[model samples]
Target: MPAAVAELSPDAPAVLLAPLLAQFAAVARLEHVTRAAVELGMPQPTLSRAVARLEQELGVALLAREGRTVRLTRAGRIFLAAVERGLSELERGAEAARAEADPTGGRVAFGFLHTMGSEAVPMLLRGFRADHPGVRFQLVQDYTDSMLQRLREGELDLCLVSPRPDGPELTARRLGEQRLRLVVPVDHRLAGRQRVRLREVAEDAFVTLEPGYGLRRITDALCAEAGFTPRISFEGEESETLRGLVAAGLGVAVLPPATVARPDVAELQLSSPGARREIALTWVTGRPLTPPAEAFRAYVLSVRGQLPLHS
Candidate 1:
């Protein structure tokens, strides 16, 4: 470390050094102590005292006085470079914080389950934007556990998740529920049924979302309630992909209702052990939200009952 930097106490508060650094920068810029004081709107003696205190703290003379003018020592110029860089970074951080808090033009980081992205999320965003057109969003689509991890890490401001996760670190508000469907290839033995008990498919091989996904957990719980574990044949990341795998006659799957009908597959409603996933708006408990994020959260709650969910 440089002699000046080495002299700075590690425990010293930055608040105490910021103003002194600002004063020194002005003096270095103008190369005149009294005139710098005038520019900073302070009495000349007070500025001189502040500069002296800074030099004492650093154990180095930063400026050499010549009558009314001043010149930076070799050490002074080096320190000035570091000070300017730090100040620039601080200014950028301040600007970003201000922008985040702007009521009319702020940003919100939002996350949701991939299953909702096809229709539900788009409809929600369109509705929210119609009322607060200036608000911007950063969207993330992932499985429930992954989105909740990001939410806890402060990477996400709000999330739309399902199965209503519970934790002391999180706050979840139930918005609505989506009915789960049993999807099978059109030519499969049970495809002709409009409703079937989950236990009826217990012996059938199932293609489902990968573990850790909210839907997969719900599928497991519902199957357990119906008195059997589903026979696993394949696992997938996306709900639509699982549906496509079903269409190929790979296996059956429990999934959200399809947004559009596919001639290759049949969707049956569950008649037993109610196959419904409750959707919730979730956030980190006690974490303060920026203006835009709070506004978006409020708007979502207001229209909770109107959220689009396909049958």
Candidate 2:
């Protein structure tokens, strides 16, 4: 161990040096023994002994006494600058931690897919804020893979994701189920039908999410189960946009019940091998959540049955 670490009292860990370093800063700023002692609210004799101990612990001469005053040694100037920055950063970190832990006004960094932001997330947050009006949220709208990456990197406190979390590091709770419907342009042959099998639309061109999105994976899986790969005619980031493509007669799409509202398009329930996607609330295992986020997660799990779904 270095001399400074070795000199720490056996019972007092090195964390104690942070405050002692602040004392050295107080004395160095004043440069007068009596004045620094007064500013520190300590007796001159006690402050003097503390400085001597500091120098001994570091194996360096930090101060030069000239009769009644003191001046910093060359090494002391460099050390003082570093100490001030360190102490200032520690203070900021403490303040941030306290703010994040506050029961009523803490912050939560929340993430979810674009599919949820329009109705689901807004409704969730509105209810959450009714109970905690002062809590702040940082919302991140992303696909599953991107959201999962941000969650692991500590950028998000929790995520509402789909196709249930798979990694060993993830902890997931199934929130509820959403039934997907086949959407087609009003003039298409399948539009008037209230229900159809997935295989019935096999030859139709499809509009889907980009491959990286979770919904796209679900779409591919449903297609595979239906015995054919879709010939994707259009791919976009938003479900509403895909619905628009269907409305324009560009292609048919499989979409969640909530996002398929357009006069020009019709939503039909699947008959055989019913199509649906499972929604889940996911977080990192063993990672702690900010107080506000934990509250939101608990609130969501408690009220999941009330989540909007097709009747």
Candidate 3:
């Protein structure tokens, strides 16, 4: 253990010293010296003295007395902001160090688009837990654009996306492609057709995904290529809700086979210029993969063939 400095002086910034800044940050964050000390697993008096020393060195009162609570002074608020920033930088540095040391068993944050999460996420999680149980997995469901942005900002360790953007900074591997099918109620007239064409159903009332979703983009582009614009009767975010709408005879929709394979609907392949969605796993180039993330990626690819509708 390193020797503790007795005091911070005018020449030295308290934020530059870890122990002093940590003590101050804890007290500032918790606003109670006893609670902060308990959380930090240090003696309350020792933590309180450290905070007092930091306040003396900074030449400002950092805490204000309330009836039964301690609050940050205005000066303390400003100093705490700087301390938070410093702590964030330190956290990243520590993450980088952990990445260097283990290259696995560290925290991994991942994001997946809504459609993929329907089935793929469960498979990935199961396999990941089986293989690397120690690693923590933080998974979030987001749109493609948002997920990609999170990956770029280092907020996510990996993302599963579709129609991957062409770029040098991103690395991607094709998981598989899924054929699009028109989902309709079993009692609907279109359900009896051996196969459907986009043009035939071009004008049908439809419950489709919102504009920016990968499925919606594919559906719109395919309809345009087929020489007609789809008449969208309703727009929704979840594939399950869209399927439910179709089952209720509200409207028809084009979706990946897996989505329509649910019990309430019948899926039909489109004959002309068949629509397909390409799924891929993406991550930042040159960044190390944490154990859970790597396991999840491998599991997705491994189970791709077994998925009900994946091609």
Task: Give me the displacement of residue 143 in model 3, in angstroms.
Answer: 1.9
Compute each candidate's TM-score over C-alphas: 0.70, 0.69, 0.69
> For candidate 3, lDDT tens digit of each residue in 46-125?
98789888887779999996754589999989988988877876786677677656755777788887877767777777
Q: For model 2, how does the per-residue alpha-carbon lDDT over 93-167 read when each residue is reduced to its tens digit?
A: 564578766778878889987878877889899999999999989999989989998888667888998878797
Leading candidate by lDDT: 1
Q: Which parts of model 3 have CA positions greater than 4 angstroms off?
A: 1-90, 99-104, 259-263, 291-309
TM-score of 2: 0.69
Off by over 4 Å in 2: 1-96, 272-274
Which candidate wins on TM-score?
A: 1
Tens-digit lDDT track for model 1 on 164-209?
9887999999888888999999998888999998888888899988
lDDT (Cα, 0-100) at 125 in candidate 1: 90
Provide the overall lDDT of each model, using Cα atoms, as 2-decimal numbers.
0.87, 0.84, 0.79
lDDT accuracy of residue 252 in candidate 3: 91
Record all residue pairs in model 2 with backbone atoms less than 3 Å apart, i.e. clashing.
none
**RMSD of each candidate relative to the true structure:** 11.4, 10.3, 6.3
Question: Where is model 2 poorest over a 10-residue stretch in terms of lDDT?
Answer: 1-10
